[model samples]
Target chain A: MILKNKDVLGLEELSAEEILGVLEIASRFRAVFDRPVRSVPIMRGRTVVNFFHEPSTRTRISFELAEKRLSADIVNFSTATSSFSKGETLRDTAENLAAMKIDMLIIRHSSPGAAHYLAKVLECSVINAGDGAHEHPTQGLLDIMTMQQRFGDLRGKKVTIIGDIAHSRVARSNIWGLNKLGAEVTLCGPPTMVPGGLARLGVNIEFDLKKAVAGADVLNVLRIQLERHSSKSFPSNREYHRMYGITEDVVRTLKPEAIVMHPGPMNRDVEISSEVADGPRQVILDQVANGVAVRMALIYLLSGGDPGALGVGQD
Target chain B: MEWSWQRIPSEFLVTGVKLCRQGKLGKRKGFLHVRKGRIEGLGIGTPTVEGIPALDGDGLVCGPGFVDLHAHFREPGHEEKETVATGSRAAAAGGYTSVVTMPNTDPAIDNTGMIRYLIDRGKEAGLCRIHPTGAVSPGRDGQGMTEFGDMVNAGAVGFTDDGSPIASGGLMSNALKYADVLGVPIITHAEDRSIVGKGCMHSGYWSARLGMAGMARAGEDAAVFRDIELAKAAGAHLHVAHVSTKGAVEIIRRAKNEGLRVTAEATPHHFSLDHSRCRDYSPLFKVNPPLREPDDVNAVADGLADGTLDCIATDHAPHTVTEKEHQFDQAPFGVVGLETALGVGITYLVNTGVMDMGQLVQCMSETPARIFNLPGGRLEEGAEADFVLFDPACQWVVDADGFQSRSRNSAYLGETLTGRVSATFRGGRLTWRDGG
Candidate 1:
């Protein structure tokens, strides 16, 4: 079946076949991006609203760029300056937005299931940019797309995630997407940073970074949110860097052809050293660019268009 | 002596129903006779009288009224949510004839005056019996013990510092010792607040994934363990409230096996809904000792089935619509539970085969009554005819509008349930009847 879901909530809710379909359509969009003009009028008449309750730079730019490319009118709502700052409820704010006859709503909320709640209230298509510690599906899609572009197939590929696996919505979405794509995933972090019982999801939980990175083809490192953790839950930041930090020394443990990735705003020498992040094996920058194309594909498919029927997406 | 069944002038007679008396469900068909606020008499077969007011109790179960060991009426303070009158109506609708109101009220039920108010107000409503549970601490602040002796004399059946757990080990020991001497059990909300800091839901995959803060199992288990240790030393009766985690169950089970004076309770929400239900981040799903995983839910069911848990209490906390309408993190942590407790227990426990009808009644009524040393939970000749008649096979949808509860924060709203409380009688009078 085609993507009949009106809301693109999470990767976990999407099947492997649906994920492949989105990626295939995304690959076709890259050809459009390379054009000199890089503008499509397929959605010229439609109005899309980016209602972000959480602050973001990269993800906001990525979606704005994609919506402009699709020729859809964009409405960006800043939570800091909105009626929400005046003590209005989320439902009240969302209903006011929906009254504008917006075709789609791209929401980045601090609370989990915020988008799911909005999707039920609004008649428009809802896109979850990022929701709480829940899934960031577009980020997940782009990360997997970047991996698929290089390897062609991700079946049986070993993907290792290190750093703050307990609080990373990125890690959760990636786990769902990567596992669906037949990748063997291993999550590594401190005992308190990585959640318990992930093994039930077929994930291999490793406490030692050295052991986790040994057989890895991909290392997706998460950033440490120092503000969220106390000195007790965190203990020592320097100690965390010493044991779990990704540096040139740890890079030697990976396979020769292995890649390193991060959803950034990265801490320079903490989560990854500059050498490894700027090295030839680093695909972090590519993930940012792929983010736009995958998001454009999602908007088109969820707008009730069959990407499989599009002759341009036959590849 | 053959009595005339047809010519009696009693309010109502429930005939041809099976009853769960004490712990055993009856095999023989029996008819309950009611008159002047007491069980006049009961006999087998169609009562021999035909003209009397009667209801067809075919395929239904009659038992001593359901008793909730714990609940928050929110009265004497948060009346916007519920008062004794509204809460008792909710209780009667749920087939409960008696309930122990937790001491964490507006001013907190710490004195004999509050205890007196609750009973008088509950009686005035003409619904179920509402026993005010005295706070362990004077203000429920975990500082000093309340007048347990005076409160008991004022008609309080138990003592507890429920909403805020009595965190001080020393203070809890004192409360337990004092409650024991006063002939009342000390029920406590068990969770070490220090370890549970800034956490909202159960700490696990769901909390990690949902980005919501977590209340770790160790937070609760540590408190459960410490309390059991103290109870052993004090030799006092300790009633654990809302046992949710698996580790807590193991500790409680071991305590019971060792014959310590430990009794624990589990809620329907704990045994039926898991942490995954919080995936939507509805404040409706938020609660203290928040919903746990499936394994933990099963463990609660196992605890109940194996007699490790003494009773199934509603913990019928009510909140107003405005209070619960906020975003997940911004909203309060409780849902209206009184109206749906019986339906949920029958749907999840009895129908799922985890418990039989008799076991379900014992957990809801007999056991809680026994533990608290209260009256009722039995259908005997001289006892007041406080009974709940329910259709175990009745299938109905739960709607917040249909509830007698003042607040409509039910977690089971819109779900279809297998059982319905048909009629409830308090002191031989029909206090509540479905669709009546």
Candidate 2:
């Protein structure tokens, strides 16, 4: 099945078959996304709205670009917390918008299940852009697409995610996506950065960076969220960088075929040295490039499109 | 919007009921007679009385009125969620005649006036006995002590800083000492905020798999360990609220075995659900000491079975539908439990043969009443005629819409429960009959 679900809420809910189905359709969109005058007519009349409760620059733009390329009329609902929250609640605002006849809702909220909440209240499909420290499905899908491009098969692939695993929604989503694909996922960071008990997701927990990266196929590094933690009580940046930072020397010790990835905007010389981030094998830009394609695939799939979009029925 | 109290007639007879008491069930069927708010007589056969109505208790077990040690009535503030009147109806419907309303309300029952407001409102509601627990700290801020002696004098049954623990060691010790002197048990929420930092559910593998912030077992256990030490030093009775984890259970078990004056209660959801229940991210399954692992659930059942856990409480936190329908992380934590507590206990505990009816009644009634030093929880002569009538085998599907509580956030919604509360009696009168 392309997607037996109505919403692209999280990666955790997708099965291996459903994930592969979405990725296959996404690969086709990658070609369309790369071409000049990237636009499609399949969803020309579909109305999409961006409901971002939290301030965001990157994710909203990525989703907006994907929507526009799909030829959908896009409306950005700028909900200033103060004005809308004074007399109207979120459900009321969403109901008012749904009354205007929007087709799909692309929401970036500070709360974890905001899109799911709206999906219940509204009569349209919903896409979660980013919600708190919860899953960002599109980011997870793009990262998976990037991994599949290099490895051809994610099954048995060793993927190690490093740095602030506690506060990074990116890490959480990637973990779920990578696990669903049958990859050997390893989470490496200080105890302060990585909250205990994630090993239940069937991931290897590693504190020492050297042991973590040894023979790893992909090292997905995450930026430290300073606002989310007390660096002094958690771990000092100096200490964290010294222990787990992806320095050039650390990259040299990794398996020769292993690739390095970071979901930017990167903290240069902190999580990763500029040398390794700009090194020969860095696929960080490719990950961003694939994001638009994955989101395009999601928009196509979640807008009630079936596998018939590709002239095939879920192979 | 409060319901008027129903007056008790001078005399009545409840015929052919199975009498249940502490440690054992009555050998044969019995007739119970009540006159003017007191149990007048009990005999082996049906009793004949003139000018007194007789209620048939066929296929029903009559026991001491269930006493809930912990529950949130949500009055003074958050009336949209629950009020004393609606919560009392819920309690009555759940087969409870007396419930200790926690001090976590809007103004928080920190002083004498708030306590009196609940006592008076409960009296006016005429549905259940509403005993108020005073906050251990002023404003429940965990910085300074409240008037424990004055609140107790004003009819506060116990003390607690419920929603959150008394965070400071010094403040906790001081409160413990004061409550000890006043002969009231100090209830602790038992969580170390620093260790539980930013985590929501149990810091188990399932939590990591779901990507929700995991509150470590050590977070609850460490505080439990600390509070035990504090209680020992202060010579105060420490009552652990909503015991969830195995580690905490072990510590509490050892403390009780060692005679450290410790007691604990387990919520029905804690023993019934686990962290895996949050796989779908339903806020209804979200609670304070968040549902634990499967092993922890078993340990909780074992704790109750072996008497390591002192009581079975609802922790019946009611929240508005809108509050619970928000995004999972942004949503408030809790589920309406008053109307479902007994049904769930009968379904999970008694029906499963984990504990018999006598043990269940003792935990739900006698122990809680004794712990808080409240009245009721007995069916002896001259005792207040407060009791519950229920069919242990009655099966019904849980429907939130069917709840008497103001909120519709019951965790057991859509679940099939075995026991059903038929009616509740208080002060020798029918306080709440199911259809009434």
Candidate 3:
């Protein structure tokens, strides 16, 4: 039931067993990343390019780290340094990259359907790192992996993603992943920011973040994108953070053992306070570590590599 | 220059002495010349007026054409829906000499730059004069006010957040204060969000029977009530846009009676149709300020008749076929009104014995011009010659495929309508003429 070598373009394409298979493979790869000898030869002699058109130090580095750990040669193609300045079409750029014998492309673009466009045009396997506030599949997978590692299973877990749901790729991706993993996800933010009918996606929704975060097994905080602020989506960053931020006081209301997580380059004080982000119950760093392993698993699984060959002894 | 005194055509002889000056003429005897496309003169007999064609104006009312106070010419950003050129042509065909375009585009017209862009693009199209409305809030976010003075200075005729209601009262009040200072009207699309959440069709037995979400009348009334109070508090000119419900009509009626500087507009659909039309779950029947009960339609008709409703504005919301071809709740609200408005007005108001043609002209032409401070709604000389020549007896079917708008989103498609516009003139220039 593993994903055959096709474009992992959207969550709609995945069956329940395929999703479970990805998670199981990701869990095994997570154990491999913790070992002293972290690198593998699963994708040896193959190249994976991280073509991130948007600004992201974390997702890019995590994918690069994952590719390097899987013994795949890594090339970073940032929009700042790329031929995007020369007005090369995205299709042309992707074709040029694929022409270099690149086996896979990990793409992040600032448009919702950018990655899907590349996937359609190129012969190489395309993994969407992020696509314009749409979905970040690896981040969602790693989040599920982190939750599974902490709780032994994601089944029946109450997971809350609080803040900027309207502009969060993380939220969209996580909703799909968590729903598939049998976790009851709750989305909480300002009513304007929290999309309507998320309950239709099998998720609970709340505007009051304080009430939403309580009794949750995982409190995943999403970053409020500043560009969205310029569009007047929110009144102000300070005002948004005041009402919905994961403060030390707010965290106190959660189950004592419940973990707080953020996909970082943390707007540490804006979304989650320094105290809570760096707190004992915080899995912020573990999520980052799990990101590389989960991505390694994604690349390995999608490229026809056997999941059991990773040496974690799969069921 | 040659002047000729001719004891000429009897029609001219009876009207005046046949004294002909260069280019000073009327009909066949008097001469009217266009020198480099500018009107040189209009009185004398001259045969040397080369390349200046003349039409015999026997019984035709020749003056500056018509102007529309409200038109949703979706363009610049969402051309898949409609463009300025197509919309302008539609306006011209409808006998509109000028159109005050709504500000609810993709990158909503909230700033001076977007406003300038709209003006520039409209001018380049050269079909009719397009005066853009500035959004009340920046990007119509409803959180803060846009620079009203900047937009006003940029030749914005009015201010509105037409697609969505201004959700915040404080911000709306502040916007009104700015409008008060500038002496511009704040046109509000009054729908309180709390009562209207995700409901597509109008609230009534039809919605309940169809198992569809019903948009309540309170959604519009609550906000209209709030805006009327806010307008009174600020003493600002408030224009209620597309007033739909009986409750809203009563409130606006009271406000006008109290001598509040408040005016309201009812769209053609509001006066013509009611919630019963939505019983089949037709998305075409869907609109914002969702079509209310028959009593509401009756109230709107009374308002239009009694002058409580100041004008009949076509909230001509155009959408692409793909955008409209969805389930009742999922499809976008609004139907194309520019092409169907006059016919609907004729059928529902004029034919029903509720109003005469003069009253229709007063509401549709005179009042909107006075409220928005635009010229050319009147047919007087020296004013922009803006007027629509309608047959008043011609009947035609509403055909979406034949419309000039880029989108086929008209709710009235296939429905037969009365009163067709025969010709439209703008600044004494023929912009549209029905086939001879």
Q: What is the interface RMSD of each candidate, in Å?
A: 3.3, 3.6, 13.8
lDDT of 1 by residue, B1-436 (tens): 2233334344567888987777778888888877777887776666765555776778878899989999899989899889899999999999999988998987999999999999999989978888889988888888998888999999999888898888899998888888898888889799898888877899887787677778999999999999999999999999999999999999999999999999999998998999988877788888887899899999999899999999999888898776676667666788778778888888898889898888988899888988998887768777888899888889999999998989988888889988889888888777788887
In candidate 3 the C-alpha lDDT for residue A214 amounts to 74
lDDT of 2: 0.84
lDDT of 1 by residue, A90-113 (tens): 788777987788999999987777
Worst lDDT run of 10 residues, candidate 1 chain B, spans B1-10
Ranking by DockQ: 2, 1, 3
Could you tell me how far off, in angstroms, the CA of residue B364 lies in candidate 3 after the best superposition? 1.5
- Could you report the DockQ of all the candidates, in the order they appear? 0.37, 0.43, 0.01
Worst 10 residues of 1 chain A by lDDT: A80-89
TM-score of 3: 0.53
Better of 2 and 3 by DockQ: 2
1 versus 3: better TM-score goes to: 1
Per-chain TM-score of candidate 1, chain B: 0.95
Judge the docking of candidate 2 as incorrect, acceptable, medium or high: acceptable
Q: Higher-lDDT candidate among 1 and 3?
A: 1
Kindly give the stretch of ten consecutive residues in candidate 2 chain B with the minimal lDDT sum: B1-10
Per-residue error at A123 for model 1, in Å?
1.8
The alpha-carbon RMSD values of the candidates against the true structure, listed in the order shown, are 3.7, 3.5, 13.0
Q: Please report the TM-score between candidate 2 and the true structure.
A: 0.93
